[model samples]
Target chain A: MFTSIKRIVRSGFVGFWRNAFVSFSSIFVMTITLLVVGTVMLGNQLLGTTLEQIQNKVDINVYMVTTASQESVLRLKTSLEALPDVREVTYTSREDALAVFRDRHKNDELTIQALEELEENPLGASLAIRAKDTTHYESINAFLKEQQILEDPSAPVIDRVNFNDNKEAIDKLTAIIDTVERVTYIAMLVLVVASILITFNTIRLAIYTTREEISVMRLVGASNTFIRGPFMLQGVMYGLVSGVLTLLILYPVALWLGPATESFFLLNIFNYFVAEFGRLFAVIVGSGVVLGMISSMLAISRYLRV
Target chain B: MIYFDKVSKIYNGGQSTALEDITFQIAPNEFVSIVGHSGAGKTTLLKMLIAEDRPSGGDVFFESLNIHSIPKSRLPQYRRKIGTVFQDFKLLPHKTAYENIAFAMEANGRTDTEIAENVPQALELVDLADKIWNFPSELSGGEKQRVAIARAIVNQPDIIIADEPTGNLDPIATYEVVQILKKINDLGTTVIMTTHNKGVIDALERRVITMDEGRIIRDDAAGKYVL
Candidate 1:
């Protein structure tokens, strides 16, 4: 058993090296497939990061009337914070709002003179509410509406709710993210399946050329495993080499795209690739080996039947 | 010993008959030559012996075991008992002559030391020891066929089946191949050969089973080249 294994491995290496052109072509095709798969993975990561950044910037701002007390505003903030969907509610006091307005018009002397001539600060205290997920904003907005109704209807303490103004932008962003996620997943699935089939047929063609050699092996009394072992090893080698090649190829690609992606989406793909090198290596190389092996096995089985 | 008992092979549901009710026995260590024209069932009969093609109506026995009925898993072990050579010299084009012979030994689970020792000796026996490293494409027809023979006998099988081994060789190479086969037979290994060459048949003067349309027309001890 040990001897047979050794011979099979030796023969596999010999066959792989001797049939250099065939082996090289197989590896080349497999590397392309692996690159597609790896690129899809990186694209998904970039998309996810971009979407999360956009989501973090989306929130509902609640404005308080100038006459509303700090205690009442704190109570509203505490209630909004108690909601399960609300991640955080940041309170800005009327004094801080007026100070921010002053700082903004600090460059404009006309605006400063108008602000100083005013008897009181016009800026209202506000609370900015953020939800755990973009989708949870609707429920949080509903909760704030309930809070508004609880106030005095004739003379309301709440000045305004800005959720409606931001609603169109949030919904559009959410729809875009959902559509993109679905399309990317479907495209990735289709690409992966297509790559597998192409690799399979390539291996099949390689085996077809060796059909006569396979028959000769059988006639010489080689067992099915003995006959198949070398080809399996060849398949594995193809996968191993192609996987490493894909990874190496991705390094340069990630470097080129890193600055662009980082500037646009605030995610450096090259840094992600390096940080996730272990996982990327496992996925790409593992896929290459598995695809190569399965293709080889299926292709050679047709010729193995005596 | 081998026996073919009333074996008949019909292809494509009786569209053509390759073998019809053939019965024959080959005893141990006997050099037998099968002589016939093309499509005369000589190749089919040899295939039946190797269990490459199964008989439709009868059984072929290697000792007491039915060659055709041997389970698929055990078929390799069964085939290893007999060495097979072909007219095309079916050596892998990518493998060297030494590797070609070593492949057979490797298939039989021979030790590395044994293969390292026996492959050279087999090549030397075929008198192509100098061409051990040559690939099939690099070698001539006779040289490639000799490497095939070396592959056949390297593992020391009980029988060697050479199917038209000299069909492509020149008179000189054919003579050389026949001499080596004769020498292998002299070494007490049963050599069954199928040939259309009358020169080779007459020169052998061994047991000849002449077939016509899948039936043995003549079986003679020390036979001559008579159709």
Candidate 2:
């Protein structure tokens, strides 16, 4: 058994080298397929990073009445923090709000004088609320609205929630995220399926050229495994070579696009590629080998029927 | 020993019949030649013996095991007992003459040392020992046929089936191939050959089974070329 396996591998190498042109063409086609897969990986990362940056910039602010106690506000902050949908809630005391207002007006002399004329600070305490997911913001906002009423009805502690003012922008970003994700997933699926088909057909054509040889092997009393082993090994070789070639090709491309992507999308693609090199290798090279094997198996089965 | 019991073959739902109610038997170490014109079912009969084609009726037995009834998984083991040579030579173009011969042994799971020791001897039997390193394309038609014959006998099969093996060879090359087949038969391997060449059939003076259409018309011991 060991001897047979050794011979099979040796024959596989011999066949690969003997049909150098066909093997090269198969590797070339498989490399293009792997490149598509790699591009999808990078595109997904880029999209994910961009969406995360946008999500971070979105938040809802809540204003408290000037008469509201700091303790009550802190208690509300604690409750908000306890909510699963809420990622964080930051509170600015009335004094801190007044200081921020004054700092903003410090650049304009007239605005500074107007702020100082008011002896009591007109600015209210506020809490900035961020949700765990962009889609979770609506539930968080509803939860805040339910807490708008205070136990002391005479003094309304909650003055206003800024959710309505930012609703359009938040909704638009959420929709864009949903649409982009759906479109990207579908596009990636289509590309992967198409790549498999193209690679399968290319390998099929290569096998077709050697169909006569396959029959000869069958007639020579070669078992199905004996006939198929070399082709499968060739498939694996195509995948291994193409996988490495695809990665090598992507290296310079990622480097060239690194600065442009970093400036425009706020993520350096080349850095990400380097950081995820191991994972990328596993996915791309692994897929290449699997694709090659499946294609070869499918292509050679018909001839083995002899 | 081999037996063909009423082996009949019909094709395309009886649109054509390649063989009809044919039967024959031969003991071990016999050199049998099947001769006929094209469409005489000569090739089909060879195919049935090899189990490459199934007869529409009846059965063929190789030493009591029904050749057609052998399961697909065990077919390779059964085929290894017989070496087949074709008119087209059927040598793998990419393989050297040595590799072509070694391939048969390899398929049969022969040890590397055995292959290394025997491949040269098989090539030497065909008188092309020096051309072992040459690919099929690098060799002449007769040389390729000889390489194919070497491959056939390399594993030392119980029987050698040559189907119009020398159909593409010239008179000199044909004589060389006939001589090799005769030599292999002398070494006690039952050789079943099919031919259209009158010279070969008459020259052999061996058991000749003559066929016309799908039925065997004559089975002669020490038969001459009689159509």
Candidate 3:
């Protein structure tokens, strides 16, 4: 058994080197496939991070009436926090709101002068509410409306509700992100199918090149396992080599593009690749090996019947 | 012993019959030559012996074991008992003469030590010792056939089937290939050869089976080229 395994390995290596051009072509094509797969994975990750950042910037601010007590605003904050979809609720005192306004306009002379001329702080105390997810924002908004903290004069008597101002922009952004997520999924599916077909054809051509040799081997009293063992090993070698080659190509490109993309996306892609090295290795190499083996198996099955 | 018991083969579901009711027995260590023109079912008959194709009717037997009846898993074991050589020489183009013979041994689960020890002897038996490292393209037609013969006999099979091994060779090369076949036969391996050459059939002068149109026309002991 050991000898048979040894011969299989030796013949597989011999077969690979003997058909150098075909092997190289297979590895090259597989490398490109892995690169595309890796890039899409990175794109998905980037999209997730970008969407999270955008969602984090979305929130509703409820302004209190000038006559409303601070205790009532605190009670409103507690009530907002009790909602299932509401992620967090914070109350900013009028003085604190005024301080923030002053700080924000400190660098602009005209704005600072305008703020100083007002003498009294015009900003109202407010409750800022954040939702757990973009989809939950609507539920939280409904809850706020039902409470009428800002709309109904008798209910909490808040001066204004600022949620509607950014509602349109947030809804558009959510729709775009949802569409992009769906498109990315479809694109991934298409890429997987395309890569499988390409790899299949590539390995088929490689096996076709060895069709004569395979028949000759069959005629020589070689058991099916003995004959197929080498070709399967060759397929595995193609996968293994291409997997490493993809990483070789990917790492340097990721390194070079990391800082460049970081400036645009505010996320370092190289760090992500490195952080997920083990999983990426498994995915790239596993796909290559599986694809190569399947292709070769299909190719060789027709000729082995003799 | 090899026996074809009323074996028949009709290709493509009776679109054509390649062999019909062919019955013959080759004893141990016998040298048999099958003679026929092209498409005489000579190759098909040989294919049946190696279980390459099943006979449509009847059975082929190797030592009382029906060749076609053997399970597919055990077919390799059955085939390893017989070695085959082709007119094309069927030598792997990339393999050297030595590696070609070693490949056969390797297929049969021969160890590295056995392959190393036997491959050189097999090459020497075929008179290709000096060109053991030469690839098929680098060798002459005769030399390539010799390497094929070496590869066939390397594992020391019970029978050697030469299907027009000298078909691609010139007269001198043909003589050389026939002489090597005779040598292998002399060494006690049964040889079943098919050919169209009158000189080869006459020179063989052994048991000759002549075929025409998928039927055996004559079977003669010590026969010549009588068409």
Task: TM-score each candidate.
Answer: 0.82, 0.89, 0.84
The predicted structure with the larger DockQ, 2 or 3, is: 2
Error of 1 at B23 (Å): 5.0
Q: Write the per-residue lDDT of candidate 2 for residues A1-306, one digit (tens) a residue.
A: 998899789978987887788788878878987897899889879888987998898898989999988888898899999999999899999999888888777889998888779888888899999999877888888888888754477866778888876778878866886787788778767866776677677767777887877787778788999888988998899999999999999999999999999999899999999999999999999999998898789878878774
Once fitted onto the true fold, the runs of candidate 2 whose alpha carbons sit more than 4 angstroms away are A149-153, B93-96, B129-143, B170-176, B220-226
What residue pairs clash in candidate 1, if any at all?
none
CAPRI level of candidate 3: medium
lDDT of 2 by residue, B1-227 (tens): 99999999999998999999999998899999999989999999999988899999999999989999999988998898899999999888878999888878888889989999999999999999899899999999999999999999988899999999989999999999999999999999999999999999889999999999999999999997788
Strongest candidate by DockQ: 2
**CA lDDT of every candidate:** 0.89, 0.89, 0.86
Please provide TM-scores computed only on chain A for all of the candidate models, following their numbering: 0.92, 0.91, 0.89
Q: What DockQ does each candidate score versus the true complex, computed on alpha carbons?
A: 0.61, 0.64, 0.60
lDDT at residue A178 of model 2 (Cα atoms): 75
Clashing pairs in 2: none
